[model samples]
Target: MGGLATAMLGCPGMPELPEVETIRRSLLSRLEGRRLVAVAASGSPLRQPIQEAAWQACVGARLEDLTRRGKYLIGHLGRHAAVFHLGMSGRLLVQPASSPAPAHTHLTLGFSDGLELRLVDPRRFGVAVVMPAEEVSLYPPLARLGVDPLEGDVEAALASLAGTRAPIRNALLDQSVVAGLGNIYANEALARAGIRPTTPAGRLSPARRARLARATRDTLADALAAGGTTLADGGFVDGDGNGGYFAVALRVYGREGQPCQECGAAIRRAVMAGRSAFYCPRCQR
Candidate 1:
């Protein structure tokens, strides 16, 4: 096969942490130890200005390591590293060398193995920035985020929340509290933990906090294994162009007015922190 998937897409939407993780896993399988043969930018500039020289520096460099911090992908290419952020609706697709580049493909990283990885984003929000290998953590875009929810220190995360009266739902969205959480999984985890979204973060009993942490970790892990949630809009998908099965297992997200799968109560939606939160009142509280 030439590419990562068999489909062509324009723009979908922002992929949350789990979706981003799934994409990273896909890249790792294809990119590890591969030498980058070329780099090209074909579309308009993304949310940030494209540095032509930075993109060019990737040429002839080997992908030594690949990792994810928050929602960003860090590719160690010899002396330089490139960080990728899939803004709303961005797709990082892998294809064969013979395939024609898709429309709105902002960047392509050609590898010695004949696999071409394309970044397509009609919205032009996706970007790849090249930086010094040793200074990736200090890079401006990644410096302020919280720890990875799956592998990060959960006790430290909970300790910080004990002093905040912020709504538990809204607090989970804060990257500084626990990196890479988005609206959908936040709703799902809270429901799984049987905690109300509107509950104050600091008011969480120690036991509830433990359950929330467990639920958050398990929810994200399960979603990643299931290839991340692909909503009805088809916003999030893996490199293989497949939608996720995790959506079928969702407890409360996007299920407003529908009966709760666990308690049979009517699911409800609330506006918190300017985002919609779906929950079942009886099950959550």
Candidate 2:
């Protein structure tokens, strides 16, 4: 493999907006309009406990729509909606009802068409919950999410960070600041914006903030088009179990010590807020 490909290889990370949006789109066609015939749980708890009764309420309800907010997938089912979050190592797979499920499968929703949607999370950090369809927007998790870079005015959102003293990269990861941006895209966006990840959020000028905002949108758009980033550990995949191709196109997320594709300077890595931030030393600054 080439250097770029080699640099993309790294351990799994959480699914950000792009990965979650990709999963939502991949599952929409197969799941929407299909009646949920059954619901099952593995009795293992995730980030939140799997309430079989709440999920059971979704049974027999036709899936009217599947939408995304931040990193959550919402399935509209009559009076109820099933919400899903693919935590650090979670996956949502669509397979035949008769197909054997992978281990750590927390929740399973059987459709009327012999297909089944499964939530498999090895680390148990994902969530599967059901509540009134009307209440989805009011749900704490969804309600607290800030501006969605793709769906909302990201420039305005970034502007709100003008006074934040946290590192620009960390501020971007704040869901209340820019919903759904994780470390991977945060680092990539900083590189694209010609800003260092360690730069203080409050220190960014208006022009730089605008540049970073645009870079964030562009980075996410590219990742969504590529399906989503699937790390070397194969952490993220679409509902069809296919890995995304964006990892190879990553500019800085996991390329520590690698040559900067733009400046030939070695990429640098910094530990910030317990997560790794990658940046081009010469290009970003």
Top model number, TM-score:
2
Models, CA RMSD each: 5.5, 4.4
The positional error of residue 131 in candidate 2, measured at the CA in angstroms, is 0.6
Candidate 1 lDDT (Cα, whole model)? 0.82
Q: After superposition, how far is residue 64 of candidate 2 from its true place, in Å?
A: 0.8
Per-residue lDDT of candidate 2, residues 1-285 (tens digit) = 232332243235578999999989889978889999999999999988899998887788998999888888888899998889987778999999999999988888999879999999887878888998788889998999999889898888878776788999889989988888888898989999999989999889889988998999999999999999988866788899888999999898778788999878988888877678899988888
- The 0-to-1 C-alpha lDDT of every candidate, in the order given, reads 0.82, 0.87
Could you give me the TM-score of model 1 versus the true structure?
0.92
Model 2 scores a C-alpha lDDT of 0.87
Clashing pairs in 2: none
